[model samples]
Target: MLLNLAIKNFAIVSFVEIDWQQGMTTITGETGAGKSIAIDALSLCLGSRALANTVRPGCAKAELTATFDSSNISKATKWLAKHDLQQDDECIIRRIISIEGRSKAYINGSPVPLAQLKELGQLLINIHGQHDHQLLMKSQEQRRLLDEYADHQELLSSLKFYQSKWRKLNNELTLLQQNSQQRQAQLQLLQYQVKELDQFALQDNEFTQLETDYKRNSNAQQLLLLSQQCIEQLSESNNITEQSSALTQLQKSSEQLSQLAELDSAAAAIASLVNEARIQLEEASKDLNDYQQSIDIDPQKFALIEERYSFAIQLARKHKVAPEELVSFHSNIKKQLNAIANDDSRLDVINDELEQCFSQYLEIANSLHKSRTTAAQQLEQQITNSMRQLNMPDAVFKLAITEKQLNEPANHGIDEIEFLVSMNPGQPVEALAKVASGGELSRISLAIQVILAERIVTPTLIFDEVDVGISGPTAAKVGQQLHKLGHSTQVICVTHLPQVASKGHQQLFVAKLTDGKHTQTKVTELNQPGREREIARLLAGDEVTDSSLANARELLAS
Candidate 1:
């Protein structure tokens, strides 16, 4: 149940604090007295969209807070606990809207997303606006109402899951079927590319090695000539008797230095250096001779290395890749070919999965159909009885459920639901929009709300002038139904009818006051005498005559 509502700078209400009570509370005011301001404030706290215009003139922001007692509301309590927002039995929801059109929501002093606030709000209260009956004309709204009344959430969730899976698989199958010819053509191209690459058989890092081998083999003759010249200059000349080679000159110098060393110690060091140079020269000459012998000038081997290197460059150009990247490119082509080869098997798998999803969807949908069928019967009987009590003794309400076309599958299932009604005896039932007059529609809407209220577990229900098209004894009946509903849950009604106002266990009067410079709305709880005067004002306009006061007292007495 709603405990209190505090609103600041909201609409024309500068600041108002309303302490709500148990049972039915009627809010009465003149036409422009801002009776619905409280409702609008509560709606904002419940996650309704807020606009900058909702703030009072010249105000920076608007703030709204709603306090509820959630001890008996198990669903709300569980939700609070799950969200880590629980604070014992008290649940407070607050909303602040800035002039910049930004808003914030809080639950139990903890910031929350607007969606979470709305979700928790649904478990706390259900508001029925004056224009709610207008929504009943829509077929989708009719289906939703029926489903809500039947509590088919679990079945609907299962059906939705299967429907989503079925749609995914069906889309895959369609794509595969549409692209089969294109896929076949692509497969042939990829197969040819893979086979060509296989014949070339390029190995990793082989391109660099091929270049090295080709260069080395092409220069083998030049390398051999250079080695022979070095060997002849160091050790032997083309004329063997020519003692002008580097090794012969170094050996003669060493013998001369040895003889000088006996005369001076410095000459001894110079003799050792000359002997080391001769020894190094001889070893270098031997290495050059060995290298010249190892060089091969075979043209056949050089031709093979050149051909391999040239072919690798040509293949790289043909594949539009660097010479080193041909190996990876070839690997990718083989992978594409393999994927295309598996497409036929993938098509078969998708068909099987689509069939399975359809079977599951149909199973859950059928179960939901049965549940709705049963709920419709019960709802029809109850609303019919309620309508008779609301001064429509001959009204008949029915729910029509028919199958949709086989090809027209929908996420909500394959059923078309419509509300049917007949307003008079011998009048064939027709669609609600076609048969019900404005007044009759309002009464029917009220009847349905009253009946559904008995089944709903929400702690509070707010009706914002839902009795607009009703009057006289019918207005009294609407009041009685709301009052009766209050026995099980808290009911708040904003009304203009004196009969309805008289039925409330408590009454509040909304008055718009102006001080030349400012206009504001104020709500005041009415005591016995105050209630009588307010009801009189509602009955006889602003005059509040003695006769109207007597009538107000008589009505309250009943």
Candidate 2:
């Protein structure tokens, strides 16, 4: 229930605070006295869009706040707890609109996004504006009303569950189908690449080793000629006798120095140096002779090595990779080929899953369609009965659910639901929007609200000027209906009719007060006598006669 409402700099309402109560609280005022200003402020607190000009003439911003007692509103309390915004049993919702067109919302002193405010607001209040009657013409709204009346939350949940699974499978199937051709083309390219890389028989370190062997073989003849010349010059050259060779000459010099060293110790050091030099020359000659014998002059083997090296370079260039990295590249292509090979099998599994999901969705949708059909019939009879009490004595209401033609499953089941009505007997039922008058529309809307009152989760219901195009016994009936609704929930109504205002357990009078240069709106709760006078004013217009006061009293007593 709403406990308090505060408004500041909102339109012509500079500052106003209203203390509200349970049951029907009717707000009455003369035309242009700002009766709707309070409701507008309430709307802003509930997350309605605000205009920059909503701020008063001299004010920089407009602010509105509503305090709700959440002790009785379990849904609201649960919502607050879910969002971590709960503050005791009291929930304060505030909205501020700046003149520069910026808006901010707060829940229990916590700043929140507008979307969150709107979501939480729905769980707290249900506002039926005068124009809400036109929603009867919308088929979507009609379907929603029937579903609410049915109260088959479990069935609705099941339907949603099936719908979700089906959509998931459907999306996967579409993706696979769209990419099937591309995947096949990629597989073919991968296979060709794997085959080409396989023919190379590439091995780690093999390319480097082969290149080394190729270079050595290609220069074998030059290496053999150079080593043979060195061996001949040092040991057994054809140009010099073996005894006259450098190695033989160094050996003779060392032997003669050794004899002199034996006679004189100073010569011993020179003799050792000569002997080490002779030993080094002999080892060098032996190394050169061994290298010359090891050289291979085979032309065919050298050509084979050269061809292999060129093939490796060509393949590496073809794949746009370095020579050493070709082995790693080959491994990658093989892995891709294996994965592509599994696509067909994976696609088969996905198709089976999709089929199962589709079957489940269809079964649940069919069941949901049956339940909605039964609920629609019961809803039509109830609303028809309500319309009679609202002054449409011979009214007839019908809910038409037609099957939708589709190649695949749809989201909201298979039926298109609409509400049809006939105002008088023997008349064919037509779309409510086309035939119902403005007054008839409001009354019909009220009747539906009354029927669904017990099922609605909102703790407060505000009827903003919904009494338009209604008066006489009809207005009285609307008032009584609102009063009945109030028995179950808090109802605040803005009205110009005394009949409706008289039924309120609490009455508030909205009036405009003006200084010479400024105007402001205020709301005052009327006492018994004050309510009587206001009702008298409503009954007798500008002048409140004695008879009008008597009539107001009688109306209130009734």
Best of the candidates, TM-score: 1
Ten residues in sequence with the least summed lDDT for candidate 1? 403-412
lDDT tens digits, residue span 398-502, model 2: 999998765566777778998899998899999988889999999999999888876665689999988899999999999988988888899999999988999
Please report how far candidate 1 places residue 141 from its true position, in Å.
Answer: 1.6
Write the residue-wise lDDT of candidate 1 on 1-558 in tens digits: 999999999999999999999999999988999999999899999998986579899999999999999999999999999989999899999999998888889999999999998999899999999999998999998999899889889999888888888888788889889989999999888888888889889899999999888888989988888888888788777886666888878888999999999888888988998888888888888888887888888899889889989999998999899999989999998888888778778997887787777878877888888898999999999988999998898999999998665442468887889999998999999999999888788888888888778887779999999998889999988888888888988999999999899999889899999999999999999999999999898888889899999999999998
Instruction: Compute the lDDT for candidate 2.
Output: 0.88
Off by over 4 Å in 1: 204-309, 348-352
Q: Clashes in candidate 2: how many?
A: 0
* Candidate 2 Cα misplacement greater than 4 A, ranges: 197-317, 320-352
Q: Measure candidate 2: CA RMSD.
A: 7.9
Identify the leading candidate in terms of lDDT: 1
Q: Report the CA-based lDDT of candidate 1 relative to the real structure.
A: 0.89
